[model samples]
Target chain A: MAYVSEKKEKGIAVLSTATSIIVPAILGVSLIFTMGYSSGLIYIIGAPYQLMSLFEGIIAGTLVFSFAGYIIGSGKTYRLFAGLAFGVAMFFTVYYIIHSVDYVVPNGLLTVCSFIITGAFLPVSQLATVIYHGRFLRGLAVPAGISVISIIVIAELAILYEDSGQSNLAQIVTLMNSVTLVALILMLFVLISRKSSGTGRIQN
Target chain B: MGSGSLLKISVIIVVLMFIIIAFIPVASTSGVKTQGVQTVELESDSGTRTPIKHVINIYLENHSFDNLFGIYPFDSYTSNASLSANLSVPLNLLSNRTARDMLTEIPSGTFSTKDPNEGYVSYHLDFNHGKLNGFLNGSGPQGLTYYSAAQEAPQWDIAEQYGLADNFYAPCLSESAPHHLYYVAGYSPIINDYGPPPYIPYSQSIFGELSKYNISYGVYLNNTAYRCASWDFLYGHTDYSSHLQSWNSFLNETSDGTLPSVSYFFSQGTGKSMGPPNIILNGEMLLLYVIDAIEKSPIWNSTAIFITFDGFGGYYDQVVPPVMDGVQLGLRIPLMVISPYAKEDYISNTQMLVTSILGFIDYNWEMPALNKMVDDSYLPLDFFNFSDCRTPIEFSPSAGFPVPSNIHFSLVTNTSADNYSSLFPMEPQIPLDKLGYNRTGSSSVNLSSMGVGILNKDEHGYTPFFESVGFYSMLVVLEIAIAAAIITRYRRK
Candidate 1:
């Protein structure tokens, strides 16, 4: 009788985990599409520029969520480092692919890719972290906090550079790249320190 | 899970979305006041005037006064004398007096393959504190370039027949986007920018005024992505969306004689003769089609067409624009007023701007001024003397003109006689050419043999492609994607 209740509790936890991630992913994707459509992308011929930026955000979010999930689910220091490294590599690769392409990929293909990445991969990865850790908000919070801070800092630097009469296009680009690199290094250091201290690792 | 939790989650999401949307700054329609102040009165031979029932504003893209209308034959007595006399006082001056002599500088058949840079910063640099000679040394390759006499033959022909405002200028020194915003709304606060984000709200516009009076108005766009149609302010408001229709709807209405009291026509952004990268001849042909439709319609007698360009697209013009309230007026642009009441072969040397159209609309409809700036500017009613509405003006459409083969070319190496012939075709030979005007100087270019290209087949090429797979398809795709996502989520559960 105790064993049956234990199995039921595990099942209920899995269901709860699935519900949490799936609902948010669906809501996020739907909100993004609605915003794009209502913003006059419906009348435009090809994919509106706004959708492309939204796609980049989804790609970055999926990478962070999945990497965090793998690190938390494994509950090992080495896995945490490995996952962080993989996340960084994937983020840069996706960014390079999006920026360097000369020809436009069809909007439909882009939409489908974005939807699959956000809806399927995001939920599955988030569910892993949620099930093992009983909550994944801490893991999610770290990356979200980092992203928000980096974006705000980058935006401020850009605005300041624009306001400065002496700054030119090349100088601004260089400044942004330097700031991004420094931010990346700082984030990696934080992740390494947390892993070494065994602060985020789950105990069996 | 229980249905109660699902309901709570949905409600929470809905409330959150509402909160975010509510913070997005809705445009206040309360602040704008209509002060009934009459600025300019029309001077006409007859004391009584025929009521103008319809006003059609057709806005074209980039071309300067000296570039398009430099060589247009002007009556020196009326244009020069009136402008000189009017300059003593604060009356609007005509174009012929303001424009610099380009007879020696720009050759008869000059052509360029390169497009000039006409960004906000570039325009400011080119202005050079109103010296106006910095075009050549400015940011772009074709900044100093002007359309030759041969290149401007089509527009010149129209100007000769209709009422042309030689001294008309763009209201602001900016790119197409801001200029377009200024066209519908007397003021555009968001200057020097483009895009879907930072959508402007409908706080101030001629449309809002028209709505108050219950006057009918429609904005017809050739391309959906044109700056005016893509304006977030209009799209965001449900009240104005129905009034925004396709360009074809305008044509159909003209044919059916069902056009609204006030109609605005915006050309396609590219390949429709908007200049720079696109061929200029394509734009002329589009204008011709609109004119032909209007001329053929029964509403021709009652309708008045105000054709003008939005701003100078980095073209060389010798005139230094006047400063108004710390902002330098943009360079001189070509303005033509076509109506039964428009003076025949008459050049009105009045200084006009995009605001003139709004002023005329306000005057005819007995509506209040859009704002103080518009109220101060000269109205275009001076272009028309309603003493002669009994006889309509006759316009011969330029038929069988060969469309330019190359849509894109550089100014340096694109000196083909064939490309030049597209502007001045020999077929249905131009009346000006018959009246001893040699369009092709020394070059022997045959226009009859040259085959029509993409432009002749369709003025706006592949425009139907968007119409065929339009908003419906977009919605369908959205619906399918959502359904698939929902199904996938359920299967995962």
Candidate 2:
């Protein structure tokens, strides 16, 4: 029974960690690919443009996050399954964006900016995990670094807005910021609850 | 508080945030503001007059106003013009409508879609008594497709720099033939594209009227000088055949200062029309060439160039056509007035038709009106500012993207086999010296509430939390402390 409980805790840690890292990476790469394809910076044929970018982003993101997971000492099998599950979750997240999010500018800069900003969730989640492990400064550093990167991204979006007067694109920006903030708070809550419940430490 | 108490409160707060996020709609952002008034006052101009001597009408093929300019200056990622510089607000997909509402009624259009069904009868079905919801049934989803400013760089650039008429309707609710007839004559006897012998029995025409007053007019066709033969066939008169000129002649005339008092240019043959096998890139290129030629000419100061489509070509437009004189008006088509006297970044909401061109001509030359409709039609004088002659704004001809090898047309041709470039010879290039000016400057402009002319601060400010550098700096300090703690813990492990 002790062994089973330990195995369950390990599984949960691997699953949550992989999900926190991989999903946002997929979304980030997807937005980049989409921006490139729409701007005519990238050439692709034979499939629908949006679908092709999404598929390519998933593959690239999966490969990248898998390496990161491996470096972090996660089990190979756990990382693989978690990657697949989170990839599917990211696909649905993009689908929701397509169906629900409106006010697309011709250049598609707004949608890409929003999704890239929402990608802050990855670092925020990492920060929570590190804090729960009693490495408060290290965890705080991760989000701080991400925040600086986000500022640069937002500055570019602001320049684009100034040039275009495309206030409509702001809808996606607001929606994405709200999602990222909520997810950050929720991740912290989940981590705090786990620590208070005397849950075993995440196996690094 | 104990860690357990802190955890409980955090969970509750997180849940509430998620619920709030879920309920927030994506369309809660600011939208384009429009005025309810019909006309707008120009920045420093009070009275209207005309400096237009040469009237040039460059007529292209089918496309509705909404099909091309649904978002107008905001159609592309770049704002082409300012809202303030624009005297009048245009009615587009973004006007008074949320993005969700737009997606529900008429989803955003895509590029490379098949051209939709368009004709006299089909247009009425699409009209659906002004509900404007019968596009799917009347012409299929293809009709609902619209081009972004990225795809229509030339049109958007010209409209933003000059004047765009959003409420200009086609004189007839039919295809190219009748609309063409309405252009030369104030009216069309037939409702559709085709009819019996003497397709247009209306002996009276704007061309004949010009000939009667000996005002000098030319019909320049782009394909070949020979296609002008159709003019005789359509009108049953060879009287104006002498006035028929080739595209090359038209360009040469602009520079030679021998351009006719009135000129009607058609790009039907050179694939410059925006119909089936819709090659908008070629159309844009053709327009740039024409504008470059005109702007460089001796007649540039005296010329007022009107660029418009002959018909809507079965694209989705939300506004229903109004009825007049027991005949229903046609779909809304885009109209741009380009001249030194033309209003800058202005949108004219004035209800107008093709006959308005005749009205302008009559008003300009002090000639009698062509007919009652021409007499009643609103003159395009409102689109010009006689008080101040704005210098000719140089527009870049670069499409800013690689042109597609070809655009496919599923309606009229076999898409798999018909490549536009391969089928037609490359358009003849005008001499660089003839253009007289080098194309410079980026196509984008800084747009505020009222576009380029007025510099109002943007109404939608940047995200507050994201733009706070101070907050981010604190976060960086916090992050550094956490990283050192992490290293210490790892060393112990």
Candidate 3:
């Protein structure tokens, strides 16, 4: 906050961060869901020439907000930056998977579910190394594992929705899908119990 | 400012410039997004029907004049003044379509035709180099045998009584769609449509025009018969169902004398679904069938049967195809017109395509409403002997040998000095390992979706899972790792 107030350049950084990281994550998700049946739609809509506006704007916005956050509270250095990047990458992947399913990914209900999985999976996976081994990014492992499980559950949902107008993801067509959902549910239970004492740093 | 800090400012400036350049567009287009490319829509190649009759046309798939005629036993057939001065020129004769598999590389003896089961990952014009952008190379038994040429031959022989063109050639060197487009339309721009697919539509085709005159046309395919989308547009616009024939229904054609003015018959898709190895002979057989039909039909002199291949199977031909867009389309393919009006021992050098067939129909019947893509392209006038108009004469179909599967049609080598040092990449020397088309079963024998000759030597054939977003994301990860290390070091200090 002080940096942006003290220097004009800091404000520009905030704008850059929003432009670069935030926009693509959102549009990329939206397109993935819509381009289901007409897979070929990727060619014209995401044309190379059009990238001038898409990817650039995203990186700019990401730079601004992220750099501003870094300066606040004794400068976050690289740990926070990496956490955010992993989270965004996870969101992008989820968006792509839903979009490529070759069928409409349901408007309100399915969309919300997809976002949840994206939000949970990425950080859990990246921080796994740190968590088990008691290292730098240990906090991220939980979110990363959760993201993997979420993909399975969501994939089951997408396929179920395609097969029937309404899908119960628990009824999986493949053994793998069912196994992932079961594991994620159990993992989520353990995580919630461990966090009940409010001793974990992840919340902050 | 001190030079030390000046460098940092410049670095910041460059990074900001790159980000700004990116943002200006990304921020603006955040509202818009797309999935894939859209195919082109244009007039189809189907022709219109009219009264005045006699039409003759021909198509050849991959064999170039030199590849087919270089070893032709012409001395025994036509003893000319010179030992064989002009024999290599295209002959409109009824000869065997089987030739020895051409070499995979340009110069003969330098490369083998034996295909490596490298998966599509390795399948490129050349594997070692990073360029897997163009077409697949195959050694003979002319990899040109996709359609059931042998099955259609009897029908074509009967129709050729009116005319035959010995000097026609393929417009491009690449594959099935481009050649088919060239045959039906004037230019093969459909191949160069770098945008979305369905580049040309049937509504813009010759068949589309023929529908205007109520002339019927049908293209029966099997499965998602992967070729030009124009085929679908034509079939769909003409109110014909594109029945996907199973292996058993391969020959189940319901078209009798009710056959449309232009009826295209193929085994559908590629490989085992097309029936046995005998399927490669479809082009020859279809022509014979057309010939038989014309002999039995009320419109004998008024019909034309075309037999052409989609592309050269990355094999070598001695001759140089005419250049388009600074790239060579490969050598001249062997095109034979089996018509009585076709001058015997006559060789014409006029370049032609599928559209010219429609153009011939337009000129003969004076149908002004033929699809313009075909009508718009220059007709292959030089190949036809226009000096005299003669009545139809019937010729007996000579029984050719049971068409051979093994033959050699070697590609000529690159002796050019600037092979690699040129401004851009050119076809490299054929790898010595690819000798013959021994990999006949290289393609999926039965499955329509499975393609044979999957080369995995280079990254060109297959898209890495880490392409696009994966690549950039990894770069971002690296930057984050660096920042993390810097922060950790600061904490320790």
Would you give the TM-score of chain B in model 3?
Answer: 0.48
Candidate 2 per-residue C-alpha lDDT over B44-143 given as tens digits, one digit per residue, 9 for 90 to 100: 3111126777999988888888778876545324432333223234787767464214432222222245666655545655776677777776556777
- Which regions of candidate 1 fall more than 4 Å away from where they truly are? A1-204, B1-50, B74-113, B139-141, B195-200, B225-235, B390-493
Choose the strongest candidate by TM-score: 1
- TM-score of chain A, every prediction, order shown: 0.31, 0.34, 0.25
Model 1 chain A lowest lDDT segment of ten? A39-48
Better of 1 and 2 by lDDT: 2
Ten-residue region with minimum lDDT total, candidate 3 chain B:
B439-448
Indicate the DockQ of the complex predicted as candidate 1.
0.05
**Model 2 alpha-carbon drift over 4 Å, by segment:** A1-204, B1-49, B79-88, B96-112, B201-203, B224-234, B397-493
List per-model TM-scores for chain B.
0.66, 0.67, 0.48
TM-score to true structure, per model: 0.53, 0.49, 0.43
Query: In candidate 1, how many Å is residue A197 off?
Result: 12
RMSD (CA, Å), each prediction: 16.9, 24.2, 18.7
Model 1, residue A35: displacement in angstroms? 23
For B1-493, candidate 1 gives per-residue lDDT tens digits of 3334433453454355446435422322121111111121233222112457779998887777766665454323232333223221111222434434422333543443356655554566577768775665443546554554355655654555556776678777766656766677665543443332223344346765666556777888765544453244332334456888877788789889899888988775555645656666567657766777788787888888999887888776777888654556888888888887665444665666787677677667665566655565567765565755634433343343433333222223233452332333122222332322212111111111121111011111111111122322333233323322222222222
Each prediction's number of clashing residue pairs? 13, 16, 158
